[model samples]
Target chain A: MHRRIVSLWFPRLASDRILRINPVEAPFAVTHHEKNMERLYCLNSQAVQQGLVQGMGLSDARALCPDLRTGPANLHADHHFLSALLRWADRYCPWVGFDGNDSLLLDVTGSTHLLGGEEEMLEDIHQRLTHSRLHVRSGLAGTRGAAWAISRYSKGIVPQDKLKIALSPLPVAALRLDDATCTALQRLGLRTIGELMAMPRATISRRFSLDVVRRMDQALGDQSEQIEPEAPKISYAARITFPDPIGLYGDVIAGLERLLNRICNKLKRQESGARALRLICQRVDQAAVQAELRLARPMREAECILPLFERSVRELDAGYGIDQLRLEAFDVEPLPLVQVDANTAHQDSGDALDDLITRLGSRIGLDNIIRFLPAESHVPERAFVEASAAYTSPESKWPRNQGSQRPLRLFSPEPINATSRIPPRKFCWRRMHFSLVKATGPERIAPEWWLDDPSWRSGVRDYWHIETKQGRRLWMFYTPRHPAWFVQGEFA
Target chain B: MAELEQFFPLEIGRAHEVCGAGASAFAAMACGADRSDNARTILWLQLDWQSDIVNPVGMTPFCDPSRIILARAKNQQMLLSCAEEALRSGAVSHVITELYRPLDLTAGRRLQLAAEMGKATGILIVSEGMGSNAAQTRWQCSPECPTSVSDGHNPKTAGLTVLHWELIKNKKGTLGSWKVCWNAQAHRIIVVSEACQ
Candidate 1:
């Protein structure tokens, strides 16, 4: 396959990333604070129109235009947004990589033909990017270095044979050299790349840095340069664009079934199962509705997934008509077939349990569903912790009642009014007085000092398993320092 | 034993309502009726009643509190729809819903049909009044003794909570009223006295 590399440079990425999230029409600049001084890190078109240059001190930039608005530069968010753009560019080619922090490199050698000729492919990219309101400069060449320089220096594609001529008019900065190197070359009267190339190779290597010669050689294709493509993502998506706008709910369900079947087929081929599936219905009016189903176990069967959507399908409001339907599965796991005899009617109860989990998870929310897991702690509240069933599993069997019995029901500590802490012969709780019929010794428990628990701020607790005369088994605790008694739990 | 089985058993694929002021007591009883040896997940659909959480320790004797899921709906319509959706989900073996007011026949029928379709049991715990609907059985329960003294051998143990219930409507059998108690040792409901025929 012929190497057809395309490079896209995002000049206003820092500011564009911010504006894309928060769109404001006023003149704004992303500022950076350095050494107790603030300076402009990036400027939008509005700021640029007001003759504001980047790297200028904040005070000076404000002087140029008194109404200048400033925002703190977020390099992290900018890099994240650029990575998303790189993934978006995968539609054009599989081999896509970040050129720098703000640019992308795509190897569309065999892929460009899929979208008509190379010229039409570039036009498609340009048009779509412009539609998204992102300002981009692009170039295509035979080498990564040439493509990088052409994108920053010149416009459009450069033929492999005409690489030297195309790069000659560009300045030394086009080779992506450091500022000090560019200035040193400029002082030596090597202003244009053409002048640098005319000089003897040995002379250029000795006077300027070896990097200058290497960058020139790489750009001219004398030495090959390779790009590190972005890591390929495992995508499980099945999409269908309608021939005509479908308005009916039945029609939408039909579309969903088709997509779901496709996804299940794909998953079956890979010997994997999906834990979560998302359905996106794009309407004719441009409003899209999404319905997501989370599974308790990895599932690949269409019958299992289709019914889960049945309850949530009504919420998918196909405003006007849904013209496109897409189903994407996430968190896929290997689901090897479990060997079982045909005659044995032992259907995996796991499947039934999973169905229950999925149904309850979707309706009541997966977070609300909980499972009790024995935590490695001695404290009563910390002895067992409730975990979201969708995420965690019970690791250990609950410790049995050996010497002492624990309450079946526990509540957040409620203060009890008791006759001055003498094992509470009588206590007033919830506006009702209870006489202690039987009492167990104080089970002293110390707080985990290493961990800061607001509830355990009282230091140590002496717990008692007491039965009230009213037939209520009460688990009460007394604090030594506070000399107070409180009811923490009750037996069933 | 035969009479206890006949007492408003929470049959799968059927819709039942436990009405009157003591809805929570009957609701807890319905949850205890889950017959699966392996505990099935439970979803509590909260509509009008705000506080339905049992004493955490108290739940241990009845059902695994860890398997309980709590969901709150905005209005009566949403609550009914949510209940219908939960019944149709077939996710849980049983769904215990709290209804502040009686549902109309249409809404109740929809819920019943959904329960049948999903192959799960629906237990509606309604507060006060008896609005007629399509449920297979309607029960009226109230706390009777709350702490009735069992055989005085274990006086230290808190007294058993006794409930009086009347099977006001039973589509499959004759109506009856009986007294039942929470057997702390068995973690289940046991009929203490004979039913009044």
Candidate 2:
């Protein structure tokens, strides 16, 4: 089947979203600050009409149009708007992707005629977008390259038979070449697509970059170019519709339990388990309440999931009864089959740990649970890194007997007021006074210069493990840079 | 969430609940309880806005800080329910929770039952507030001054820390106080000062 691709260009997508929210009739442009200079990123139609162009300095634009309004360039908001438009465009075709910065590519090959032929589809899209106050230009062709070139430079649909004839008159820049290459072609007098095409292929490749020749060939349809369309995510969802709405919590739980069983069985058959699950309680009034659970490890067992669901299910207000219950299992992964060895103690313990993680994860979140892995560093705090307990395993045993001794717990560095003595006979911390019974040498630990730790801003430190008269074994550090002492850690 | 009832039959059970005095005291007890061999893994669940102040580095005195699973719930309801779930799983060795306020008697009973059913221990760290609950034990812990003798490395003694703990309520035993220190060499909580009634 012949492919039918549609390309839509949003010349002022970034500026347009802002203009849409606050309608502006005067000339306006989006400016991006780069290298200490504000440059015009994108311009609206009014700004373009006033002779302002993209990449022109903001100062020059303002000089040209005294009443020109400008806003900071928001690429994020533009991309977000494009994604929203992408969902809306799903009405046209399921396969739609944003091409480059300000364009959308749709593969409507076999789907266009369903919405009353190509012309009707284009007209519908144009009218809907125009109704929404979006300035859009669209082109439909047999190939992505042809469609893209036509959308930006020409108008309407270009049929397969006339693809080459229609592109012949356009400038060489229509091939999306860089300005240097376009200028080189212009200097060589090969200004139009027809002129570039008439030249020898080997000569064109030798004169310009391979990309230049490749793009020209792609535009002319000599070589096929594919458009990457966004793939819709597959949702593993199961729902039970009730003929009569059930009001009781038990009835809702029953329906949910039934739906869960079906989905879990399906997941088990697929050899997969869901890390995240969502229960959508569809009320009789059409309002839906959702309860979600996240697991540390992927789980498919009904025994493991249902009990957790029960608590969340009770939280949902059925409100005027519930007509349906839908359950979705997302973030699915293959649950590997483990060989049940005779050494069941070790295996069972591992499984038990995983189970504990999942249950705890469903409640507290997996990120908060962490495992410490020994890091190769002399700095006391940098000696270890936190890894998610559910995900990472320690690679090697912790380096024992590293410095004089690593403390059991490191505090967030509390400063201590101490006597300015070589051994500092007494010290005060947390409003409590401790007379030093005995003192150890300053174990000099230089700060890791590569790291910018806020606490380490004082430079190198002389750490001293001191025993206070209060019977406390304290790990304190004396920074020579600022000549101050800090009570950093407490043994246990 | 899709329920997978066809996979395994749902079991009904609850967990054991115990309350601790404060954050530091709770941390000490949790560290001590976790030292027991029964726990397969430890879950440290903190309620909303309660980022764990327990330095993992300092946790070297208790157990492998890496082995402790930390979970932060967004609210009190989530914190309670999550704690209950962790206890009921029967998978973890211990469940430690930090809450802004204590659970009521009913919720405490539910947690206790869950822990019993799961064969796991649950420790609830109540900050500032207290409630009448069905916990097996209620403990109050406070930091005690350290007393140590030097080992000739320097004139200073380096490795001794102590906490004074009061067993405020005991379901089976008499309420008492004791001074304990973490012995890093043995990785155990040794009672330095014997229990005083």
Q: What is the C-alpha lDDT profile of model 1 across A1-492, one tens digit per residue? A: 558899999898888877877888989899999868999998899999999998899999989999998899888888989988998999999889887788999998889789997889989999998888788999998888888888898878887688788889999898889999999999988999999899999988887779999999988888888878977766899899998988786887888899989999989888899999998888898888899999987899998789888878877777778889989997798888766787655445446656766776777566655666666777777776666676675443555445565665456888887636567777788887788766777899899998999999997989997766664567889899877888887654
Q: What lDDT tens digits, residue by residue, belong to model 2 across residues A1-492? A: 888899999877888888889989889888999878999998888889999988999889889999999999887888878988988889988888879988999989899878999999999999998888888999998888888889988989998899889988888888888899899999999888888888998998987779978897787667888777667655578998889888787887778788888888888777788988998878888899888887767888887778767767777888988888889997798887666678775666666667666666655666766777777888877877878877776444655443466665565788877635365787778787788866776888887888888888888888887877675567888887787788887653
| Highest-scoring model, TM-score | 1
- Encode model 2's per-residue lDDT on B30-128: one tens digit a residue: 554443457456677765474334555555545666556667778877878877777886777677777676578888888888888787777777743
DockQ, all candidates in order: 0.20, 0.28
Model 2 DockQ vs. reference = 0.28
Interface RMSD of each: 5.2, 3.9
* Model 1 fnat value: 0.23
lDDT of 1 by residue, B1-197 (tens): 23656654577887888876456556666777666642366667764334334432345455555566555655677667767776776756677777776678998899899989977788887765644469888888765533343445444334455567778887787777776776645656777675556
Estimate the TM-score of every prediction.
0.68, 0.64
TM-score of chain A of each: 0.73, 0.64
**Model 1, which residues run further than 4 Å from truth?**
A1-96, A106-177, A180-225, A234-246, A269-274, A278-286, A316-348, A393-396, B1-197
